[model samples]
Target: MSILRHWPSVRARVGRELGLVLALAVVAGGVLGFLALADLVVGGETVAFDTQVLMAFRQAGDAAVPLGAPWLPTVMRDITALGGTAVLSLIVLFTVVYLVLVRRPAAAAFVAGAVLSGAGLSQVLKAFFDRARPDLVPNAPIELSASFPSGHSMLAAVTYLTLGVLLARIETDRRVRVFFPFVAVVLTVLVGVSRVYIGVHWPTDVLGGWLIGAAWAMACWGVVLWLQRGRPALAADG
Candidate 1:
């Protein structure tokens, strides 16, 4: 009877442990992947892959025209805008305000801190790499910044995934927990792909951005979990 009565607690503890382990593993893998890509990119080894991928989206003999339905370019532009600075900033602002209004100050701080730190890290990485935007095709948005690690892709992953994890942690429903993170992943992927499709960022640039951003988000979550381990329940729930 006691065993059965305590089963839910045991299960929850195990789940938390497993989640921590997975987050750490992702951090390790993401760092390694980013470093490997950086080495190749610095050595100019990714030029062929980058050029091929960039050109694949362009119409034959015309770099300006993307190969697809007439409206596809417009769609891509809109999708890319979802990860733009203005949109992401507004999203973070609103989310933080919502969290605060609900009296979840810790959660609000966590979200704001994670996003701001991720943005700073993205800029640092970009400045270090000093990579130029792809010129194989005319850029749709006409971006003018260092482009090794795409700011849009990184910021999207950081913001959406962080929010997803927060939502998942507070929710009790299995399906809802799964749904939030899944949508976050989808949105992150779409933003990254849009950057590449619109010729604003190299494929590797997006890849690097995703790797580092995910690692950062996971690391931040892991720290929060560690900090909240002593409490009876998730701080997020409070």
Candidate 2:
């Protein structure tokens, strides 16, 4: 066809890549949807595995807390802070301020949108599941909305991943720059695990959190990639 003849190769390749990314997002979302549905199906509005795991994790945390070294609690607290609202809030504020004060509005907006989108999705998932907290922890100091997919785990993946993406976009070194996402992935996982270690969430909750969060991060980064390709304003050299 005439249209095919005129189409640019680069554009065509990009279109194919975008289609693949979109397919991946759909599959990921479907998996989460299925998991949620299965949860409702298995126990009729109850999460069995998630509850059991959370209880087990909480018990483990309780037993370890007293027997563990003095510094462990402090370390867990620091890691747990990764999922705390304060940390995520500060990250957004700092990034926005840095971008605005330096007059890089486009980059700021793109990154902000990317991060907020992930946060919004996390809340939606939390509300959908509405799982309970661990009773074994005995003293759950801070409050939580849902138990299955931790808010902290989700945020850690979202915010930290967004930070990694932004950093990678600006970096010159290929290998070291790649570490941004790798480290963010590691930190996100550690924070999620710490939630269970500290007895606030279950192991299954963290796993679900990791799956959903990691998938969301991937989805968001996929969007960033598409945006970079689609719009000149949001495009970065990397």
Task: Pick the TM-score winner.
Answer: 1
Please, what is the whole-model Cα lDDT of each candidate in the order they appear? 0.89, 0.69
Model 2 residue 39 CA deviation (Å) reads 3.0
Worst 10 residues of 2 by lDDT: 229-238
Candidate 1 stretches greater than 4 Å from native = 235-237
TM of each candidate vs. truth: 0.95, 0.75
Query: What is candidate 2's lDDT per residue for 40-70, written digit by digit as tens?
Result: 5336444565456555543354543422577
